[model samples]
Target: MRTLLIKNAKNIITMDKDRNAYPGGSLYAVDQQIVAIGNDIPYQAADTVIDATGKIVYPGLINTHHHLYQNLTRNIPFVQKTELFDWLITLYDIWRCLRPEDIYLSAKVGLGELLKSGCTTAADHFYCFPNGVSGELIDEEIRAAGELGIRFFPTRGSMSLGRSKGGLPPDEVCQTEGAIMRDSRRLIETYHDPGRFAMVRVGVAPCSPFSITADLLRESASLARSYGVRMHTHLAETKDEDAYCLERLGMRPLEFMEANGWVGPDVWYAHGIYFDDGEIGRLAHRGCGVAHCPCSNMKMGSGVMPIVKMLQAGVSVGLGVDGSASNDGSNMLGEVRAAHLLHNLMHGTTDIGAEDCLRVATMRSAKVLGWADDIGSLEIGKAADLFMIDSRQLAFAGALHNDATLPVLAGLSQTVDTTIVSGKVVVKEGRLVGVDEEKLARMAQAASNRLLNEASLRTKIDYGRMRANRAYPNF
Candidate 1:
């Protein structure tokens, strides 16, 4: 079996039960499982040995929610100022033109960014399938993640309600319920690994309440439970969503979802910013989790999530960068920092600390993805998934007093010095291990340009022009 060893870390922040941290720590892994972790590890010889002299080791940050395909559609001038509903209508045309190559390249660019920023595991919600494209788009992204050596938990997301049926997406982009179920079954059967230390797992997601019918939500939840895989979707993200659900379904977002049996430990909602105190209690009672998207919420003006209250109420709260179009980037470390600062601003300084934000990004995020037993923290028998940053950098010169909180509290230098996933060094010296970063960026940008040009031609809108005040397209 292949072996890997890291020795003499400046500090190792283990997000374990007691929240133990070791100064001058050493970790040893046999193959993909961590075997020893402490201030002193006896055996040092291994196929790989890293002398992390001045580096702070952390449990690799987990991204509980993402739209990897949105990496190609970021910074659109027209939709930058729009809210969630208008943003969906404006971008549906562009997203419905996604090709398999675009998904592959976008995943590479996005996941590569996550890797350099210290995220080892990511869960992507890919829901937009272009009309008449029979290609396996989720498979393309899974391939990209495998090539990058990042642990992946991808949900087979489906949008079944169209504008003709009062949904946000155009009719052409929405799939039939039969088609969605068929593909969901196929993806889970083919890729869902129910074992511990799995590199890839599949989930079932029906995009959101406003984008899917009530019948589809129940069917999707039942199907996910039938396979024992997890369920994920966008829920309670915006006031617009709340308005839509209450107007159409005659109930609040959480109420409607719970009616469809969409609340449980195996289910997680993205951007749960609008849940009230009573709804938060119900969520905790049902053991449901929330993936908090701080940057995306602030950018979309959605509103701040009650993360401080959720944590206090025994809710499993985690961090997500959301879609790159919404967050405009896939930097997990940046997400953690933004979450810390945003919570401090909304709540008080004493409400949530920097280490608490890190915990949300690491351990709690893993729980959201249903991988808490295997890959959340640094411990014996857990997967060897972690990242290290050089705390001796000039950016962290005066801020290394508490290594557990240094990552969230430090400024500027967010890129990690090294990243190892599944006992394999996937990034070294703040760069991807086997990826041609320059080439990937060039190709991804070319893909983005092509999609935008096509979208502009199709819609007769100048997407390249600066139109900060322009009214967005109505689907």
Candidate 2:
């Protein structure tokens, strides 16, 4: 087995159950698992040793929600200033033109950004498929993750309702409910590995409340249970979603999910900004998880999630950058920083601290993605997934002098110097190890242009019309 050693770190925030922070520590890894963690682990037997002096090491950030395909459409001027519904309507046509190359290029670009931001494990919810694409899209994403050496959970997301059926998505983008279920089963069987140090896993996601029928929700949950994977969906993301569920389904978004048997430890909801007090209690009691997307929520004008309340109520909550089109960036550090600032703004100054936000980004986020046992912390026998940030950078030049952990807490604006997933170094010196950055950026740009130029998408940009129609009888 190949052994690797990382020695002489300024500080290592384990984020383990003990919440240990080791000063001037070392870590040893044997083939994908951590063998030892403490001060001064010997490196004589290791094949490679990385000198991590003047750097901060932590459990790699976990991103629990993202539409990897959305990376290609970031910063589109027309949808930049729109709300969730209007933004979707404006971008749906563009998304409907996605091809296999678009999916691959976008996943590479997005996952590259995540790695640079110190994320090792990422969960992407890609629900849009057009032009007769099969599970090839998910396969491409998985391949990209494997190539980059990032631990990934790519949800088999599907949307079964179209505008013809009163759903938000256009008719061409929605699939038959049966096809969605079958593909979900196939994906799980092919890729859902429950073993430690799994490079790629699959989850069953039926898109969102407004875009899928109730029957599909119940069936998806049952199917996910059969395979023992996980379930995810969008819930209570906005007032419009709440109103839609209330008017059509005769219940709020959380109530509807509970009624449909979509609440449990093996499930998580994205956004969750509009949940009420009772809903929060329900989630806590049922052991549900939430992917808190502060940047996306702020960008799309979706209300702030009650993160402080959720954490206090025992709800498993983690950070997500969400879709790139909505967030306009895939920076996990920025997401944590936003979480820190937003929670403090929502609660008091002492309500949430930098460490707490960092916990959500690392350990809590891993728990939500069902990978806590193997990769969430720097512990013996756990997967060696972690990242290091150079404390000597301008962002942390003076911050590290006061406190060793202060740089991670306050230096959210910087990039990680090194990112390792499963004992393999995917990034060193703030660059990807497997792919060329310039080539990847150029391919992404070309793919984006090709998607945008599809003839079928030329007339799909009537944002005013969609916003005007947003008030149409709530369902």
Candidate 3:
């Protein structure tokens, strides 16, 4: 058996039932589980010891929504000004050109960034599975997450309706309902583990209401509930999306989703910016969760999610960095800070305080991912997944008194000093263990260049210089 001990931290921001914060904290664990907490934890022997002096400990952040493959497409100059629908249309072309190797490399690069930002578990919504691509692309992501030592919840995302069927994506990028359901079941059977501290859990996601048929939505929900797994998708993200749903489905986004049986504890929607008071109450009453992607929302001009209202109504709300293409990075700590600022501007106060943002990122996020019982808080009998930042640094000089809330409001965005996941130190001294960081960065950029080249993408402004020799496509 393996034993690990973390001793004498500056603070432990435990997002437990009591909302506890411990100073001069310590934690003890054996194998993958946390055995005890605090200075009085009984211990006889130890295989390893992590001296966390001058460091602030936190429950490993959980990212409830992401498009990990989009790490390769970050800041593609042209799409910077585009909004939700146009962004999807533009990226779908490039995404459909992806090979299995691209998926693997992008997932690794994205998950690596996330891990460095103190994210231990991430749920990647990968919906773009190009035709004739052999082997499970999601399997590539699973393999990459294992290599990087980050817990993963990769949804079998599907797009069934194409432009031909009044949807956002092209036909070639969409799949048949039968194929989507078949693969969703296979992935859940092959990878979804319902046990505590599960590293890999799969979900069934039919992309979104506008991207899939009503039949596919209802059936996907049934299939996921049948197998006891969660369901996820983007919903009501923007005014354009609201118009699309109302015009096409003859109902508001939430009504259409409710008609399709997409309410209840097992379902969580990404964005969720357009829901009203009645809808918010409905979500809270039904126990459905929301993955609030504030950075992506601001970047793409998507409306602000009513996180204050959601919390007031007792809805389960968590934070997500969204697709790296929209967010431009995978930093959960940054996401928390953005949430703090966004809500402050919207509601005009500290109604959504720093402690609240930390809870949203950790405790509520674990619940949103359906892993609440095991890995959210720093407590005994939980998974030993956490990150530490050296409070001795200048960033936390004055904010040290409010360590639990400081991470969200301190405006500090450096990588954590160390990160431990499942009783193993995956990141030590602010670097990933056993991984070549510089080499990975170079390789990822090379892969991105190859992908853009293969997709025939070029700068948008090159066409206006009377340069018909280079035809740049606008999406």
Candidate 4:
């Protein structure tokens, strides 16, 4: 194993127990684990060293929720102005044309953008499996993550309910419960690694309460627990979801989830916007996590999630960019700025500051993904995953001394100068280490165009007409 030392950092914000920030900090690591960190850490000579002078380092940002496949369909004029149900209904027709190569290319673009913006780890929910798309699609995404060297939690997400079953998704996109469980077990047995600092871990996610049957939910939770993996799904994203639950299943969103054995620390939900006071309390009590997607919620016009109240009640809240189609981008730094500004506007106060946003993005996100013991904080014995920024940039001109707050308050979606994942510097000088980003862009654009053409022909919907109107600009 090779030992690497990072010395003379201008600032290292350790999001640890005491929330310490060290100036002129030095970090030492061997292989994948951090061995030491401080102003002056005494140790033997290393095989490699990175001089991080004039740079501010932090624990790499953790994104707890995403749909990497949706990166192929962002900014579609067809569904730009719709809410949750309408958006899903419209997009399901388009998403039914998914392909394996599309998943790989989309994962590269999404995870590549994430790494450039200082995100080291991310949890993706890949649920939509169209009719003709086959052959271990989740494995395709895992392969992409491996190539990119990003720590990944790729859940075997499923959708079972269809229009025939009184669900929003079309029948073509939904799956059989038997098939979902079979694949979930196979993925767990094949890919899951429960040890600390693992590169890839698997989870079983049954899309949502309205999309899947009651049996799948219980079985998924039980199966995930039996293997020590995690569970994830979308919940309480909007009032429409609440109404559907109350009308169809005769329970609130959280109540439906709890009834199906999905309330625990091992479980986390995406876009928890419409949860009530009691539900938040129960989530806190049960140690359940919430992956807050502020950008998507605002774009979909969903109500602001009560993040302050959730924190007050001790709920573990993390950051997520959500689906690329909804968020229209996959940059975690931009998500931080949106969370900081959006919450302030929603709360009408300075109660939740930039520090709080930064904390949730790093430390709390790690908790949400069940990695608090392994990653997140910059500490000894943790995974050596972090990012460094030259804070003397134009965006942070006047905020040099307050480097910690500038990430959220400055509102710049700038790329990091360097990002280190698992003791490897995967990004340097605001560019990927070995990736051909231009090739990825060209390939992704070609794949997206093919998908849109096929899907539009199948659905017979005229996005061109929608763009013709002033409501949507470019299709």
Q: State which candidate has the highest TM-score.
A: 1
RMSD (Å) of each candidate, 1 decimal: 2.2, 3.6, 3.2, 1.9
lDDT of 4 by residue, 14-119 (tens): 9898999889989999999998999879964788788889888999999999999999998887776777887888778878888999999999999999999889
Ranking of all candidate structures by their lDDT, best first? 1, 4, 3, 2
Q: Candidate 1 residues 1-475, lDDT tens each?
A: 9999999999889999889998999999999999999976787799999999998899999999999999999998878778888888889989878899999999999999999899999999999988898748999999999999999999999999999998889998899999999999999999988998899999999999888988999999999999999999999888888888889989999998888989999999998888999999999999999999999999999999999889999999989999999999999999999999998999999999988999999899988888999988999999999999998788887876888888777754654999999999999998898788999899999999999999999999877665656455332
Candidate 3, 250-271: lDDT as tens digits: 9998898899899999999999
Clashing residue pairs in candidate 1, if any?
A: none
Could you tell me the TM-score of candidate 1? Answer: 0.98
Residue ranges of candidate 3 with Cα displaced over 4 Å: 457-475
lDDT of 2: 0.85
Clashes of each: 0, 0, 0, 0
lDDT of 4 at 127: 95
Off by over 4 Å in 4: 411-413, 468-475
lDDT of each: 0.90, 0.85, 0.87, 0.89
Better of 3 and 4 by TM-score: 4
Model 3: per-residue Cα lDDT at residue 246: 81
- Model 1: weakest 10-residue lDDT segment is 466-475
